[model samples]
Target: MALKPSQPLRLFAEHLREQRINLTERWMKAVFNDADLTESDRLTYEQLADHVPAILEELCSALEDQDLDQVEPSIERNAKLHGRLRWKQGYRIDELVRELDLLRQVLLGAIFGYAEQYPAFTRRHEERARYFIDEAISFVTLTSIREVMTERDRKIDEYTGRLERANHELLLKQKLVGELYESRMQLTRSVVHDLRNFLNVFSMALQMIARAPARTDTALALANRQVGDMKTLVDELVEYSIVLGDTNAFATEAIDLRALFDELVAACVPTVEAKGLRLVQRFDRELGTVVSNRLKLKQIALNLLSNAAKYTKVGEVEFDMHVCGESQWCLRVSDTGVGIGAADQERVFKEFERANHEDVPGVGLGLAIVRELCRTLHGDLRFASHEGEGTTFEIIFPLRLDTDG
Candidate 1:
């Protein structure tokens, strides 16, 4: 007997069941082509499409029989499975929903493909086919939402517990911290105050040794240089401790920019030579000193030079000083080194941050200290660098030294 003509919805639904394999294949291909969905390490076809065939049979059966009881339970089970699996795979709900939409498109394209084979599929047939697919979407998404909400509630509960514990511990510790902070402040001030007096003694002893008749040329020069460097370090420690407690701690004095630059260059030479790198110092003779904390200025200059020498391996490190306006001067340190990447440049000034992966050592505190010291002096610090090219740092500030040139 010849086949009887039927409604288009029933016919298309039957066609979908018959072409379920083709539909699944097309859906998988569509998913693989999607860059967002093709992360197989996280979401493989086996995980995403395991229930596709059953999904098609049940959904098409619903369209054919007009009964949802047969399909709803299966779709709900599969939807819950997908929700848990995708969450484990690190998929956000938005990405999962996106792929589901793509699956719908691919399946609809399969329906259009069937239209060419069966003349009974009109646009009305497309609408009916969509109604069945739409029902499937609603069921799957409802179950998915339920599962996700369940997971979210569990996470919220766990995090709430952790937060409650942390708050309790913090409350207990704050009292002890309050007591220790005062004691620490007192001890630090006492220690640093005593240390400053020793630096003054060290200065006197170096001068005495430099004038002693028994002192050899080489030994006297070495002792004087070592004492100067040690004084710089000691003064730095004392001022740093004082500044940490009070930003207005360091005393300002009459300093000559020319003579200070010469002394700093001499102090930094041994460190540069140890690294087997050339250190060039250029200064404008007219850039007379300004009234500033001489020790703090020396610390900033030496810190920059040390960083330049630390990062640059083969190429020369240069320090340039010049008078900008009548009362402004610039100190620039440039290095031919492995320059900072763009991602790290902004954060390099943050405390304890390294700009590159190179084996360059240090706790990443230098730039942060440079920035803090610059703020103390009301100076402008800026940098320009390319990844492979060199980096240049310029510290520009008003003159604060004696007018005696």
Candidate 2:
């Protein structure tokens, strides 16, 4: 059932109709002056006043007829459009509510002003106008907020879907990397295994030829040395492959630094003396035990010592160990070898890279392996060298290795 308005209510509605343009102008002025409605400032007059005139017409019709049902459809449509436009203009929900409340206040103030101007419009007409304005603004505020929330939810879903797809792609790439690494390890093992079998046959043939009557000792010796160099290369390839594939390879235990140095020096002495170079050692007797990967430390030390002995012609190769800090230690290998040139120093640690020494027998996995092993053991390797003088390689290791690291 539709409720009818009194004659004064109809007159008030007609008065509002006459002042619709003025009312809209007043509302626009309020929005522009409001600090909280700053988003309206970015809009042109048409954009800021979007659907407001239509909303005012609906409000007047509902006031005249006193039938909210008749005006609801148009009010809802206009209010939804206003909400979406304000959202597009970067209005916050609070700002939207504040702007609409201002509209309600403007209409009520106009009603009170009209009642004061005319003797026929009493307090009853003013109260009726207030009731209708409250009803319409409530509906508009609800509908507008629902639209803004719907748009916000839709955007949230869109961003969530993008994040999910990105995570899936990252997982796929990680799986591909794992598969490629395994394939490489398999290939390296197969190739190294076959090469070792062939090398064994060549080594046996060289031994047999050395025993023959027509054997040239110099040529046989050279052949034997070449065979030995090939074996060393194969061994380095295996070690490099293992280090690359296994991150959990550093199985740690407590090691006596003095004992480890003594053993390493003893092993390196035979090779250093064979090259007619003196082997020198300096150890800190007070050097106590350290918790680290003994095998990796041994490999790094041996590689540096061997390189020192292999390059030095007349001068000594020094192996030194000392306490570098309160909880750190340094193992330094220095030699009067043909030192690396400044240009080649940067490329020295790269795989299969040798520093300006083509005639030197090396497949160049030595420093590369050393670097990887140093990192695995939580150590830092640094070197200083001059062209004619020598190279000194120092590795600083923590006194106590952290297993988790």
Candidate 3:
């Protein structure tokens, strides 16, 4: 009842596969704690592991008998016999091979003894064992091929996932491009309309001057003033477009807040006086120079001040330059003016959107431009207002004090 030494090498390997499967499954479960492994996968490995003993026994017997007949029952021989094994199967190799070598020697000794004791009966059993061993060797070869196929399939899956993600991003980019193109067309139409109106007015002013030569002086001056206003509007529109398009629009520069505020107040003092509004200025000496885009920051401040002046009929317009939160410079502008409504506050920053007001005059781009400029400088703008009481706009910017000489 012993295996023989004359068994095929195929049987020796099958015996190893059986022992390896069991040891691997046990070790892997202990180490991994069974993370994400499906029941089917587990069952497959378990079945393979359980069959390890039979596989190894056959291998040993085949090797001893030198017939290779027992090799047919190996894991590789029958394609439909088992499901896919988990990656953990590789762990069982050492132990299985060790046990298999021992079995081979034992069976080999049995074979020599059987041949010596009963040469007549040995031939028939040897032939059967040889057939089994041959099948088992084929099965073992198939298992290795299966492992290779599994690896290839895994790589393919990874590639497919990456391709899907890339396609999603590409679609988003295409949508954005379409939206931008439409916005550009709208902007172009607006520019052309404004230009046509400006030219028409210029033509009418020229005709009026030609008709009355004596009154031409006054008419020309008024016409020139209108043209100047038109030019200012055109400049603002162009600047806004450039700022929005360029990612690197804000060039950092060191500026003194006190000096900047003084200059802004001086520039707007004539308008403030014309409106009969009191201007109050307060500067904190401790607030030092901050590094930012000086022009953009000035544009924001000027817009807020102009908005305040436009809305206010009589009260005081207050400007305060001070340190707000920790290491942040803040410019607060308060005006006792006809303030913004709660319903319209959120939409004020959108392009070409103005609150419903009878007295105010603008294309509704001032606040939008202000917000964009603030964003470019890595700052934020916020406001609080009441319809009849007053309005306050706050600009908060991180203080990056220049240290390099």
Candidate 4:
């Protein structure tokens, strides 16, 4: 059975059909002028008006028949297509709903204008027209929001998967590099250990030859000194290898600052005096106990003091210990020695790097080890120097070591 058209609805439908083009134009103008609908600015006139004309045709048919079900398929198809296009054009869900609402307002105004022209158009016809427009706009808004959210979720998942794969590949490469480095360090330690053993045997032989009743004392003394220098180099290499391999090698304990300084100065006295240089020591009266890695602290102090004694000729090597702040302390080793030049100072903390003085008895691992150990103990090493004016190396350490490091 065919449903008969209602006279008022048929008249309203006819009016909407005649004003369709003008209504669409008005809707476009409203969208462009709306601050919230800025996404439409990049779209062309046809692109922005896509499927709207079809929607208006279906709306007119549904109004005239007074049966929305007959025109539902066409209406739904056009509305969904418009939604997807808006999503691709970067329209937010709110903007999409707002534009549709604006269209509804424009059509309602046309409806009122038609009602005023025909005396038979009553409140019942206006209400029916409003209900159909509201239902259509509601369906379009929900459909568009669903499509936009679906696309958004899919893109998020894709980007997250890519990031995970990249991080996994990075971890694998890092593990491989670490394994190679460890293998090289192990081989170096083995070779250096063997060389130290040979040097020790050679030193023993030179000592025995010197004791012989031969006039080779000067030559034997020089040979022994050369062996000693080689032994020192090997020892530094071993120390550097150990520090590199095990970051947590040192344990913290309460150490007496005055006692530690006294021990270090006593050890360096003979070397400084041999060069006709004085060893000066000064301790602040408030020197107290500190909780730190004792062995590492001793190592840093000894390296600085030894470097000072090795380079100075006649001036004093001063070892000063003072309270830097309430929670920290400072050790300053200043020397009147052949100081490092500006060019060499930058590489002073780099492995196997030496200063301009090639005659110095070192393989240049001293300062590098000192710096690594300083950082491991939550401390810092800094220096100031000028060529021929000598250098001052200062290290500041926290009173208490942080175990987390």
lDDT per residue (tens digit) for residues 1-405 in model 4? 432337788878887888888889999999999998889999999998998888998889988887788988787778778888888888888898899989988988887888898767778878888888877777766776777787778778988999899999999989988976875675467557646765776666677676864736765776677677777777998898887778545677999988888888888888888899988889998979999988888888888898888877779899999999899999899999989999999988877667978677787788988988888888878899998989999988888887776
Best by lDDT: 2
List the lowest-lDDT window of 10 residues for candidate 1: 1-10
Q: What is the per-residue lDDT of model 3 for residues 189-237, given as tens digits with 9 covering 90 to 100? A: 7667767877887777788889988878877887896688587777778
Among residues 3 or more apart in sequence or in different chains, the pairs in candidate 2 whose N, CA or C atoms overlap within 3 Å are none
Using TM-score as the measure, name the better of candidate 3 and candidate 4: 3
> What ranges in model 4 sit over 4 Å off?
1-219
For candidate 3, give the lDDT: 0.66
> How would you encode candidate 1's per-residue C-alpha lDDT over 101-141 as one tens digit per residue?
77788777777787888776777667767777877876776
lDDT of 1: 0.74
Evaluate residue 147 in candidate 3 and report its C-alpha lDDT on the 0 to 100 scale. Answer: 53
Judging by TM-score, tell me the better candidate of 1 and 4. Answer: 4
User: Which should have the higher TM-score, number 2 or number 3?
Assistant: 3
My TM-score estimates for the predictions, one after another, are 0.41, 0.55, 0.59, 0.57
Q: What TM-score quantifies how close candidate 3 is to the native fold?
A: 0.59
**Per-residue lDDT over 1-405 for candidate 2, one digit per residue giving the tens place of the 0 to 100 score:** 433438778878888889998998899999999988878888888887888889989988998789899989999999899888777788999999998999999998998798789867777778888999999999999999988988888888999999999999999999989977875675566557646755776666677676774665655665677578778777888889898888654578999988899899889999999989998889987788999989889999999999998778879999999998898999999999999999989978866677877677777788988998898888989999888899999999999999786
Clash counts per candidate, in order, are: 6, 0, 35, 0
What C-alpha root-mean-square deviation, in Å, does candidate 3 show against the real structure?
A: 11.5
Candidate 3 lowest-lDDT run of ten: 79-88
Clashing pairs in 1: 257-289, 289-401, 290-400, 290-401, 291-400, 291-401
